[model samples]
Target: MINRTKLCSTVVAVSALLAATTNLDAQKAFNSSDHYLAQPLIKNIYTADPSAHVFKGKIYIYPSHDVEAGVKENDNGDHFDMRDYHILSMSSIPGKVTDHGVALSVKDISWAGRQLWAPDAAYKNGTYYLYFPVKDKQDVFKIGVATSKSPTGPFKAQPKPIEGSFSIDPAVFTDTDGNSYMYFGGIWGGQLQRWSNGKYDENGSKTDLGKADEPALTAKVAKMSKNMLEFDGPVRDVQIVDKEGKPLLTKDHNRRFFEGGWMHKYKGKYYFSYSTGDTHLLAYAIGDNPFGPFTYEGIFMNPVEGWTTHHSIVEFKGKWYIFYHDTQLSGKTHLRNIKVAELKHNADGTISMVETYKK
Candidate 1:
């Protein structure tokens, strides 16, 4: 039996803690004892693009299942030939983590083409929704959804992809008002650059290379409809701007949206974080609302060991943490592993720059 009252109280405490944060930027780095950063969470199987969430009292991780597929590595992300998803859960951090085995796979998806990229999950009305981005038979990437009664799911697919969904890395964030919005998009092999013209193009637009004058590409976000199966409105671009209120240009590698979009609320502000792929850094922007004209804040995690810098931020048991991936498992980019560490938020709303744990 679960203690609903205790869970509710703990969740409230966590929000209060974040809401009450102050300019504690000088706070020392988290001592090693507080996190499981010394090694990957699961050793038997390779995993990446971890989307960690708190369901009830336990922490549930919805991660893309990385496999040692011999597909050649290329700019188009052909090497990351993942075919399924494995849901993981833990009673508490730095504690026993359980791999719930195969929750969803390519074979089970009739419309799926190949390479199940990053995925995220959400729970509503006693059902768990698994949102994933994958290619179809035409080799065009589109987002899809699956459902299960239990958090560790053997989810049943919806048969067709979400009509207006595209790109990779589907992150669903339910706001305080209970409205759920999804943030998604990525570049390179993820095929976001191909959609620069607002429509899917196999050859990509002529501006795909991104001239110095053009604004850096943007990520896509849309609100979940009442059915939770489709977008509530036309997908919109998540504007990443500068302090002066100008969009970052395409040539700005240091601060731009490359891939891996995640949204989290802290002190009533929305933080939109992503990977700066070419630079291998995880940066973020802040805005007043879910669909934002977010101003670029700064990088949170420095360049990681892996070629990719994908992550998720979550508040678990009164503390905040980052769930990210690295290529340390096999020293190969495609064969990556998931890791976690304490993420500090200053009272001034600035995030402390985090260096990847070397141990």
Candidate 2:
């Protein structure tokens, strides 16, 4: 027969050993040494349209997952068909990218069908709101918001899209004075769609090939209300002009606005940057305020292998980085991966040209 006291002691020791092992596994969930070292910040899966935010001292990157075209039975070929987003993060400590997992997927968003494109996130009163664009049941592109308590979240999607906001690439900028602004628009010609005799006009008001005189391909910016759910004021145009106040994209000038409008304030000046559509080069214009008569500064980044170049800029630990995407990974245009590089600004406040990482 066994001693009862000895047996009880043995059982307690085994239980303590098992508990300790479980805690060790939890702490080792992320492999810090295996973190991505160079440009394509993530390697396991494809990510695109990186909207980065500096939250609570860590850099949280919200990017669209590039799902291959033939994933479904009815999948179209060589087209953008993204349906979800994942929140990726890193801290001041090097080589530690935490995969926060799927923050918001199309399945979680009721109104969204397919095409979950570029997204942006903002924090207010302890709640983090994610703003994304999706194709509604009516097949029109609309922007909606999702909220969560954590920066990397299983965010709850709102019931409807933001009223009066249409088009793609929804970016929110919070000013220094606590005032928030939202910038969005796309399809260069669509932005230049004019008002003809009170009706919608499509390039009918063009002079000098709709470039020199008329501000074609201009993005829109508006003030957001306290809740950020609705626009607080009328949307205004972000006019694009050259340093000499001439049209940035004239018949003689090939440079023009395509899509992917992102805004950031550095040294009290607002930098409105975007990707030149079809051409794929990333460029920018600077203004004194969010509502801009921005002067085109020139190309900000060399074009990536992909047809699109959606990006976001953030200052983390006194270092500025530009987060964008490229087609180097999957070797296909639609299947792109997010990348980051040191973003330098000239002494005069203009952005320095960013060289793409080949590897």
Candidate 2 lDDT, 179-209, residue by residue in tens:
8998886653222334323233443432123
Native-to-model Cα distance after best TM-score fit, residue 196 in candidate 1, in Å: 1.7
* Candidate 2 Cα deviation (angstroms), residue 313: 0.8
Model 1's alpha-carbon lDDT is 0.84
TM-score of 2: 0.80
Clashes of each: 3, 0
TM-score, every prediction: 0.88, 0.80
- lDDT tens digits by residue: candidate 1, 1-359: 44555644554465345323311211112223223244689998999999999999999999988887888877688889999999999888888889999999988888998989899999888889999998999999999999999999999999999988998999999998999999999887778888877888887742234354579888999999867899999999999999999999876777988899999999999999999776677999999999999999998987555578899999998999999987655767788889888899998999998866533
**CA-lDDT, candidates in order:** 0.84, 0.73
RMSD of each: 12.5, 19.5
- Scored against the true structure, residue 40 in model 2 reaches a CA lDDT of 68
Clashing pairs in 2: none
